[model samples]
Target: LDSVLVTLEEVTVCFSVEEWALLEEWQRELHREVTAATEQLLASLGRWNLWGLLDMGKILGGSGF
Candidate 1:
C-alpha cells in the first residue's frame, strides 16, 4: 500500500499526455479499490480511519485527473 501510494505520487510529479491519461485511469481504479476496501472495513470493524480514505478519494477526484 505504501509502495502504491509512493508510485502514484511519483507518477503525478511529471507525465506526458499519454502518461496523464494512463494516470487518470489508474487513479480512478485506485479510488474504486479504496472505496470498496474502506466500506468493507467499516462494515466489519464498525469504525476506522474512514475519513482519511474518503479524503484521499476526494483529493484524487477533485484533481480533474
Candidate 2:
C-alpha cells in the first residue's frame, strides 16, 4: 500500500510538471503572436503618419520585452 501511494504521488508530480511546462510554452507562443501583431500595427501606423492621432505612451505604458 505504501509503495502504491508513493507511485501515485510520483505520477501526480510528474503530471503537474508536464502541465506547467505546456502552459509556459503556450504563454510564450501567445506573447510571440502579440508582439508580432503589435509590431505590424506600429509599422502600419507609422507608414500612414498617424502616430500623432493616438497616445502611444499610454498604450504601451512602458511595459517591454
Candidate 3:
C-alpha cells in the first residue's frame, strides 16, 4: 500500500480551487481521508516541525509530474 503522506502533498500543492471545491453530493470525491489523516499525523507528531511534515508528504509524492 502507498504511504498517505506522499499522495497528500501532491493533492494539496497541485490542487486548484476550482478542482478542489467539491459540491455537497460530490464531497466523497474529495481527499477527505488523506487530508484528515495528514492533519492528525502532523498534530500528533507535533506542529513544531511543520516543514518536516510537509517534506515527508513531498517524498511520498514520488516522481511528481
Residue 51, model 2: Cα distance from true site in angstroms: 18
Report lDDT (CA) for all predictions.
Answer: 0.50, 0.40, 0.48
Candidate 2, residues 1-65: lDDT per residue as tens digits? 35322222332112233443455666646654664565566567553233422333234342222
Please, what is the TM-score per model? 0.35, 0.36, 0.36
**Residue 53 in candidate 2 has what lDDT?**
24
Off by over 4 Å in 1: 1-23, 47-65
Overall local distance difference test of candidate 2: 0.40
Give per-residue CA lDDT, model 3, range 7-65, as digits (tens).
44453544344434433534623454555566677668654355654564465452121
Candidate 3 lDDT: 0.48
lDDT ranking from best candidate downward = 1, 3, 2
Report the error of model 3 at residue 4, Å.
17
Look at candidate 2 and give me any clashing residue pairs: none
Candidate with top lDDT is 1
